[model samples]
Target: MSQAPASFSAVTPYRPSDAGRSLMVNDKHRQILDGLREISQESSSRGYHAKAVTSAVDGLRGCAFPVNSYLKDGNPNRRCIVYPDFEIEFEVGSYYGGPQTDVSIVDIRIFRSETKTNTRAALWNVTHTENESGSEWKRSRDPESQLKPTPKCSGTENDSIKIGINGFCKNIDHAISMLPSHITRGNETSLGKLKSSGYQLFYIPQSNSYFRAGWSFVRDLGRTSPSDLKSSQILASHMREAHENGLFIEWTSHRGGSKPLTQAMKLLAKQGVNVAGKQKVFLSDHTSSHFEADRARRAIGMNTTDSKWHNSTKGIAQLVGGQIFGGASLACSINELINHTKREELGGKIAVIGSTAIGGGIAINSTYEKIGKLIAEHGVSPALALSVLSVIGKTAIVGVAAASIPSLNENYHNGPQDPIKNLGNKIGKKLIPQG
Candidate 1:
């Protein structure tokens, strides 16, 4: 392994975590989730993100400082519940077993695909670069190699720089079913493995899938229609099986205040998802001083209405062990503000929201949704699809992030539809590229 960076700074200033500090969670906004009980009574159907954020804020804040001194598992934060502001699901199998996985994503953008700009934005650049096998390439020459003339390194063979390739299809099952054939043909291999330690999946849709149900609908985004119960059994079964298999069943996501978001969260639950998280803000009543002061620190954080507040349902958090952390989901977008807290009162009470299956899709956008589902369903093309999905997710998110910047007016516009969008999507009625 390569040596760690020698001069890496391993310390953060002893600044307290506050409502304002949540801005650091992402490059976008600043916020604080004081309390959650209130929001639940207000909004009836925002979805998984709402509930997850509410619970996350309440739970995490409840445990953040109760134990000043750290020991081990005995302490509240014995485990650093590091919620990487983003995630993308990688398929493992069904409620049973398998080597390959289906691809999918859980995101807010899926529902927002109606607009032409959003649709264009959803379509992302997919690049298929060179892929190489691990066979050693020795420079040493015997009779054959030495006799041949050395190739000139004019320093320009774009083809030499390898990249990952993915094959997308309209029908998810169709795409997944084609994985083995591609593998057998010795096609699409990745050379640039992660150089850093630790494992992480890109939280993109099609890049994220499994299933969903109703109770989750109620628990996650707040609207529980009777129809959702249909898939509950299968979702629970899958979760239980995944738990038993010693794999991560990420039941949490960043979907929206819609029915689909709720459904997604429920499916993830049976998989032993760690916890849910969401956006939140400190709120106060017009009446009492103590009440106003205590508002942001109590169950008041649940009024997730505006973009500045935790806007999803509150029940999602109830599913996992409390893991609420602030989503910094706010209207306050300022770099300096993000780098530093907005007010001293911000830290008086830190809010932590639950996790979710929302942004996982939006970050990757709708174009890849079908691909994301394919992986989850079939667990096929795990490596190639994952690499491609991961890249597209990061790239698209980068595009979103670049736009979300305060300087850019915080509006996402991916531009006109073209080959750039839907990078891996085929033009004709072909599932995989034939050799």
Candidate 2:
């Protein structure tokens, strides 16, 4: 045995040639290598979902997704990410020779409809659609045609119908019955499964839906506290159902002051938050400092009623009635969202990217320094950039700031996470957008 060893022992997974080794090799490098391999192996395969997988992978070369691990609604040990759609594994390359490259991959998560799927076919299609929309990608080569054994989660590929439920459309029986006549073959689904069955799926409800019925009172220049109208019943109903169904509740509280975090942790702990906790829960909106409001306004965006274009009649009319405002001074559509997404990807800054504590945004890009400054001035994402959004905030609020001026976002994009270092203040006038 010691003579030459078995052939398998000599085989390394995959390695880059001498020229590919130059940088400090690490796990991230290995993962990128693995990802490359995964993509390469599938390069010549053409299935219903094959093209879709490749398309979704286009924008990833530069924007690598991270392996997100977090506590579920209650189970700390059980977790999953809401963004990644697939895991691309590979070994690292281009530095320190090929031997040091470890095996790794990028974990991707994709969420339900929105600010946001299933079997191999579903997953492939879901990712494919997403990739087609991104403007940051360059297309790859074509492939061969073949069928794959639908890979199962932990070795269970039942080829059953997978229904990804969005929000809490609880009337499962009705939803299935309502499917189009063409596909409803004697209760036969996407798969041959029958017996009127479907798995339940859920997402965190609109965080502040209950808080809005009496908005006339709560929206008093942000004077009202969340504790004023809450009940254990209401809170429990919203947060507990998903838990019962083994579904996770997305925490949607916006970060501002320290109080919000404290209350959120409590609520997440299965405890409820009332409306009057004032400093105990919701933080101040318009703070005493100018920077606080400035940053918040930047993150929270302009109120739907606020004018986006210049005050001039023509500009306001154009902006309000234009794509930015959804043709009516009040609405903004998915098309606008798609445009902004492209802008953000191109390294453009949004005047404001407003969100409630739990409201959604593109992604997390802030560091402790940017967080501290904003919090010291006015608190937000430094800790929690999520919150239960008010109806108006959810429907009408579009984050708008003074437009890209000398701010942390621009600073971070151009500099490093720890930018306060020797980078010096390259901050420019592009911080906030000015009308």
Candidate 3:
């Protein structure tokens, strides 16, 4: 050892500055990184090109580049790292100077194949960043590119290939064949693998198709011991598949127990799954739900429809139809709320209370649900105003129930039908269009 130390040759140390601090890459980014490495190896100067990518990604750890620098009209929180060979796009909540930044890799792309300069930086379209309209290189404006388009979940063409199976898919191969061709190849493959395991494939009906709830399979934990092998396997498979496909998995339980859902999602995150935010997940129309409808009505001090009406076909039309009267009512009400809220004059002594719960709008009793919700949503300002009036002990706050209005209340109390029926018509005119 002493003799070797005496005659040691001077050589450059093989240590990368970001040896311990590397840019975090998601599943999609990881794939792109692997592909880029393969391409770099074929280049004339492999080491130089490969090292450039490493340096570019490592530099992103402490960079605070503007989102606009990548996506022209995207959220400011979205940012990207551009290198000669490729660009790595990511989203972070906020910017701070540190070795580690809270970020999620959204996409990674090499230069366009048609382009002459593979080792040059160039501007890219923000729309292309999401690959919403297909890959960044493809310029087709086909709406199918918009994968999760809600009302038009089947895309612009309503011609979705309907399938009916006589028997359950027994294996992963059968499940793949049964699935609609509309699903991406990667997803179909992963789903096949999942089904190939003991996991069952739950086919959703056409009505609930818009919800786009991914395969709802049950894992029987009763069969397993404390190890819970089956449950663990299913959860791991789903998390891996979802992350690989850049899908956001939102687990829910209708059984009044969130423990299973919470545990599964926690495990997914622990396994490095790209668990997307709630807002990113799309569900059925909010206005269609009675709870949402009631909330909206209370927010604007207007009873658009009764709870019964909100659950029927009338409620759905308000959200679906573009040229229908029900649709007009929703648009008008929302517009009114938006415009009114901007007004400086928010103080008023007159409060109109409406209730369809008792005798439509004819009952003497006010709808507490409506009033309570309104007060709660308006925040402290209204309560403070009422407090000031109470302190004065002179100003009167007139709370007039909608039923107290002579026009809506008089005959309604005597009539068997709801007073709110047919927009206060003596004869019940269809307030909602049947067609």
Highest lDDT, which number? 3
Candidate 3: list runs displaced more than 4 Å.
1-22, 38-51, 63-74, 82-85, 94-99, 117-435
TM-score of each: 0.17, 0.20, 0.20
1-435, model 3: which lDDT tens digit per residue? Answer: 111111122211112254432344545556656665666566454444555565455455555541112432357656554332445666553222345444445565654341222112111111112245642212122111111222212212232211111011232233223332212112457434323221112111121121122111122222322222222222333333434444332221111011222233334444344433211111111111334323322332222232222112221112122222321232233233334532222221111111111112222223333333344343423443333222211111132222222233212121211222212232112121112
**lDDT per residue, candidate 1, 289-372, as tens digits?**
223222322231222343422112122222111222233332231222234433321111111100111222222344245343
Question: How high is the CA lDDT of each candidate model?
Answer: 0.23, 0.24, 0.29
lDDT of 2 by residue, 255-339 (tens): 1111222222334343232222111111111112233332332331212222321111111112222323232211142223234
Order of the predicted models by TM-score, top scorer first:
3, 2, 1
lDDT of 1 at 338: 31
Q: What TM-score number comes out for model 3?
A: 0.20
Candidate 1, residue 138: Cα displacement in angstroms equals 32
Question: Which candidate would rank higher by TM-score, 1 or 2?
Answer: 2
